[model samples]
Every structure is written in C-alpha cells, then in structure tokens.
Target chain A: MDEKFAAIGEAMPRLLDGLVVTIELTIFGAIAAFILAVILGLAAASPAKGFRIPARVVIEFFRGTSLVVQVFWLFFVLPLLGIDLHPMLVGVMALGLNYGAYSAEVVRGSIQAVPTGQWEATTALSLGPIQRMRRIIFPQAWALMIPSLSSLLVHLMKGTAIVGFITLADLTYQLEQVKRTAGTLFTYGVVGILSYFVFALVLMYFMNALEHQAKHKLGQGKSLWRILSPAPPASTPAGGAS
Target chain B: MIGISAAFEWHWSAAAEVLPTLLTQFVKVTLLVTVLGTVIASILGLVIAMAIRVLPRPLSEAVKWIANVIRMTPIIIQLLFASYAFLSLDLITIGVIVYGIHYATYMSEVYRAGIDSVPKGQWEATTALSMSTLRTWTAIIIPQALRATIPALGNYAISMFKDTPYLLVIGVVDMVNAARIYGGDTYRYTEAFTLVGIIFLLASYPTSLLIGRLEKRLAYKT
Candidate 1:
C-alpha cells in the first residue's frame, strides 16, 4: 500500500511535467486551428470554383483520412522531405490541420446563417466586404461556431497525446514509462485520473467562459453550462450533411 | 508518410500471396473490434449520457470531465498506453477497451441528445401511468431515443470501422497493417494500401447508405 502510494507520488510530478507539454501542444495547435479555420471558412465562401473547389478538396482530404496518418507523415516523412520540424511541431500541425477542416465547415455554416438582409444592408450602406464581415457578420457567426469550435478544441487537446508516440515525451508516454517501472495498474489508473481532473477543469473553464461571453453578445443569455451544454441534435434533417 | 500519389509497381505473385490474407484478417479484426466496441459503447454511452443528464452536478460534472479526457487523447496514445502499459499479453482486449471508451465519449453525447429529444410530456405521461423508471425507460425513452439516433449511431459504427486501422499502430495486422507491412517488406505499398482503402470504402459506403435508409424509415414512422 505504502509502496503504491509512494510510487504514485513520485510518478505524478513526472507525469505532470509531460502533461504540461500536452497542454502546451493543445493550446498552440488550437490557436493555429482557429486562425486557419477562419481563413479556410472565408475561402470556402468564395463564389468562384477557382477558390471553392480546391478548398473543398483540401477539406475533404483532411476530413477523410485518419489524422494519425497525417501526424506520422508530418513527423516522419516531412523530415525526409527536408522539413525537419520537431515532433511537437508536427503534432501541432497535424492537429491544427485536422480541426481546421472541420472548423471551415462550421465557419461557412455560421456565416451562411446570418440573415440575407444583413448582407444587402451592408452592401446598400456601401460597406466593403471586409467591413461588412468584420462589423456585421463576425459576431453572429461567432455564436454559431462556438459549440463546434469548443468540441474541436477538445478533440485537438486529446490529439496532443499522440506526440508520445514519436518520442516527444508527453503524459501518455510518461505513463508508459511508469507502467514499465512500476508494472502495476495503479500507475495508469492514477495517471488517467490526474489527466482527467486537469483537462476537465481546463476545458470546462475555457469552454464555459466562451459560452458565457458568446451568450452575452448573442443577447439571449443562459447559464454558462446551460449554454455550452450539448443541445439535443435537432432532428436529423432529411438532408443532413453526409 | 507515403504520398497519396506514390505508385509502386507490384509483382503478380506478391499481390496474390498478400491480398487475400490481408482482406481476410482485415475483416476478422475490424468485425471483432466493431462488434465489441459498439456493444460496449452503446450500453455505456447510454448510461453515461443519462447519468450526465440526471445526476447531481458533481457526478454529472465528473462524468463529463472523464469523457472529455478520454475524448481528447488520441487513439494511438491510448492504444499504446493500454497495450503496453498494463496488458501487453492481451493486445486485442486493450485495443477494444481503448477504442470503445474513446468512442463512448462521443457516443454518450449522441445518446444525450437522443435522451433530451424525448419531450417532457412523455415523462409526465409515464409518471401518470405509475410506470417505474426502468419500465418508463425501456418502453418509452430508449425506443424514442434510439429511433431518433439511428443516423448518428450508424455514423459512429462507420467511424469505428474506419478507426479499426489505428489498431495497426499496435501491430494488429488488419488491412491497413497488412498494407504497411507488405509495403515495408516488398516495397510495393501502392497496390496494397490503395486496395485496402478501397475495401474500406466498399464496406463503409454501403453501411453508410443503409444508415441513411434506416434514418428515413424511422423518420416516417415517427
């Protein structure tokens, strides 16, 4: 009993260090993803096939293939192709790119949801496209995108654990080390719990705050949790996205 | 890491020897994982979703937290961690558990939506008839929830099938693994990998269509 607890105490600090790396990857990747999602979303909104076709292809390609392949390609193959980014960078890129695809759709949908009058009004008022998008549409679209974006963030955060495989030494990798040394289930169970505890608080706080902030701007506010809480998916439209 | 455009010429004999084994094992492994994972995920997801919906804040909050943690971690990390960390000897068990739990988090959210879709008056009507919770759930809640969720549930099943490839990382020798291994061994990755993916498309595309059909049937009935 004493030994397990002692080992856990010792292992936790080490695991925590790796978890910091995981969190670091997630946060940075999320930033990259958000930026890319917005750009891709805007690109998809382009009326011309010149922009739209390639954007759709890129989105479909990423969304279709397993992200694990993308990560391996970035981490291992990219090095051979003369881009020797560290595993962490590869992890970030893979995650950011994967979520960016999903976010693009979210962005497109959100932008589309803005009342058609808003677009015409902006046009009649002689607002430039950028001005109209920035001032009139961005806020409404942000609300629509919040839930999808938050879910994407959570997925991205989880994806950081993959860095462990390329020998980048993250929480799961450390847990693997602990498993080897301790040779007990206690090590993994504890590590999983701590990870769960940390992520729960971080995700809850981050997403809840966003929900609250979005709700205020949305002008029909609810409790933060209530707002972020997954709504029952509206009955699947006969033509819901395939 | 290979390019999507890579084209490696393959010898006929090498193709003959490898393709059949690859297809057979791929089906065996994918089917095994999908069945076990779906059963575990569907049952657990329903429980967790309901628990999340009805439990006190702390418990609901904890379940949500746990789900997020599972949801965030990549399948490879968990697969590696689970396979090597505690149960190296039982590779398939660890693989199944990890994937099931991973999808379970996503599934719970699906189920939660299904549960919430049940109108409040249904609950009141059940109560008025003095039905027990189990009876109310079995007879009313689950049927309605499951029907509403046919398409979503099918999506997860297809997802699980597509995800079976992750087992390749841990050396399960499924179709993807077969392709990778054959490529590594013979330098003929193109035919093997592309064929394997085509097979996946064949299996999943039809299943996806079936789900769509099921969704329509359920919609009409409701």
Candidate 2:
C-alpha cells in the first residue's frame, strides 16, 4: 500500500506533463476544427454548387476515414511527401480535420434551426448576405449549437489520447508508462478514466456557461446556475462519432 | 528513417501490387469487424436505454453514470483494458466487444432520443387501451422509436466502420494494420496510407449518402 501511494505520488508530475500536452492538443485542435466547420458548413449550405460541392467532398472525405489513419498519414506519410511538421502539428491537423467534418453537420443543423422568418426579415431589410448572417442568423444559431459543439469538443479531447500512438506522449501514453513502472494497471486505468471524466465535466461546465450567456443575449435567458448543472437526461445528445 | 532521400519516392508498381491485398483485408477484416460491431452495439444499446428508462430511479441513475463514463473516456483506454483484462480472448473477439461497447454508449443516447421523441399521448393511449407492459413496449413504443433511431444508428455504423483501425492497437489485422505493414516493408508510407484513406472514403461516402436519404424519408413520416 505504501509503495502504491509512493508510486502514484511519483507519477503525478509526469502525468501532469501528459495532461498539459493533451489539453494543448485539444484546444488547438478544437480551434482549428471550429474554424473549418464554420467555413465549410456555410459553404455546404450555400446556393452555389461550386462552393457546396467542394465543401461537401472535403467534409465527407474527412468524416469517412478513421481518425487513426488520418493522424498516421499526417505523422508518417507527410514527411515522405516533403511536409515535415511536428507531431503536435500533425495531431492537431488530423484531429481538426476529422472532428471538423462532424462539426460541419452541427453548424449546418443549427444554422437551419434559426427560424425561417428571420431569414425573410433580413432579406426584407435588404441586408447583404454577410451582414445578415453576421448580425442576425449566426447569433441565434450559435446558442442552439452549444450543446452539440460541447459534445464534439469532449470527443476531440478524448481523441488526444490517440495522438500518443504517433508519439505525442499525451495522457494515455503517460498513464501507460506509469502503469508499466508501477505494476498497477488497474489503478492507473481508473485514474486515467477519472481524469478524462473530470476534463469532460470541466469542459461541459464552461460550454454551458457560454450557452447561458448566448441564450441570455438572445432573450431566452435562464439562470447561470441552471446552465452550469449537467445536462439532464432528456436534453443530452450522444457522444457522437468519436 | 532509413535512407530518407530514396524513401520519399512513390513507386507506382509497388502500390499497384499492394492494392489487391489491401482491398481483400478491407473486405474480410475491416468490413466484418464493422458489421459485427454494429450488430452488438445496436442490441446492447437498446437494452441499456430500455433498462435506464424502465429501471427504478436509483438504479437508472447508476446505469446512466456508468454509461457516461464509458461514453466519455478515450476508447483507446478501453481497448487497452480489454486487451489486458481479457488476455485469453482473440483479437477479433476483443475488437468487436470493445468497439461495440464503446459505441453502444452513443447508441443508447440515440435510442433515448428516439424514445423521448415518442409523444406522451402515445403512452397514455396505450395505457388507456390497457395494453400489457411487454406489448406496450414491443408493439407500439419500440416500432415508433426505431423509425427515428434508424438514421442515427446508421451514422454510428459508419463511424464504427472508420474506427475499426483502432483495433490495430490491440494487434488486430485491420485495414490500417495491413496498410502499415505494407508501408513498413516498402517504406512507401505515402502510397499505402493514401490508398487506405481512399478506400475508406469509397466505402463510407456512399453509405453516408444512403443514410441521408433514409433520414429524409423517415423525417416527416414520424
């Protein structure tokens, strides 16, 4: 028992390093994904096939393949093609592209969920497309997308673990090393899962807060405390394709 | 890392030669794993969602927590645990179980959503008609719920198909595994991995289109 505690104590610092890497990868990957999702998702919903087709193809290509393959392709294959990126860059790109494809659907769905009348009202006011989408449609849609986007973000964070296979030394890799040296597979496994759960909860808390603020701005205000509480059973969506 | 300059060259002949074997593995292993995984996930997910709905409050809450933990954690961890805990199990069996259970968590949520979409009036109507519990669920509720659930389940199936590559972590000879090995031998990582991506695209893209069609057909009907 003494030895187990000592080993855990010793492992904490190393595990923290891995946790930092994981968090960094997730944040960068998420930012990239959000950018790609917004651009491609809007293109997909656009009237012109020229824009829509390419966006659809890109989204479909990313969504169809396994993320592991995409990451491996980036990490291993890209060098052969003369693109020598750091493992972190590769991890972020692969994760961003893959999850971005899924998030595109969320973006499209939420944007469509904006009342049809709003689009008509914008048109009636003779607002340009960009101006109307910026001022009116996007704000409303962003609120509806929060729950889905939060779920996708959690999935992307979990995906950071897979980057370890490409030698990123993320939390999973760190935990695996700890498990090996400590001779405590079960203990480390429990700790690793709990860490991920805590990260997810933390993420969800912030996302809900964002949702609360967005809803409030849109005049559908709810208590901040209500938003901070975990999504009740009826409201929670699936963990998605992760 | 070996002879880095020469390794960068893409040899067309070798890629052509390796293509058949990769396709064979794609069909025999990758597709098989996905089909089996989807079957297990669908049945288990329904059972779980049903249990959560029907079971008493405390038990259901406990089940929800377990499901959430399973759903939220990285699947690689679960795969590793399965590899360790079920040491006697073969890779295919282990792969199917892990993949199924991992996705089953999502599927359960999909099921829950479908069940929730069923109107309260439907339930009250069943109760008024004095339908038995089994009949109420099996006949009315399940059928209606399943219509809403099919597209979601199909999406999960496509996701499972792509994720079969992770089975390689457990040493299962999945499509990605086959690609990596071929690449290792030739050091032509570019062709092998690119081909693997292309094959995945070929398989999943059409299926997604089909699912979109299914979703459209089922949308207003329900």
- Best by TM-score, which number? 2
Instruction: Report the number of the highest-lDDT candidate.
Output: 2
Least accurate stretch of 10 residues (summed lDDT) in model 2 chain A?
Answer: A233-242
Docking class of 1: incorrect
Over B32-69, each residue of candidate 1 has an lDDT whose tens digit, in order, gives: 88889988888888888988977999999999987876
Tens digits of per-residue lDDT, candidate 2, A59-88, equal 988998879899999888878766789999
lDDT of 2 by residue, B1-222 (tens): 445565667778878978998999888889887999999999999999999999999999999999999888888788888888888988788888988998999999999999999999999999999999999999999999999999999998998888788777677777788888998887888788888999999888999899999999999774
DockQ category of candidate 2:
medium
**In model 2, what lDDT does residue B162 have?**
82
- True lDDT of residue B22, candidate 2: 90
Q: Write the per-residue lDDT of candidate 1 for residues A1-242, one digit (tens) a residue.
A: 68767776778788888888878887888888888888888888877888888888777566655565566556544444445797778888888887888788889889998899988999899999888899888888888788878877776776666566567888777776776656545655555645644684687578768867876767766556555678844556787773
What is the iRMS for every candidate structure?
A: 5.9, 3.6
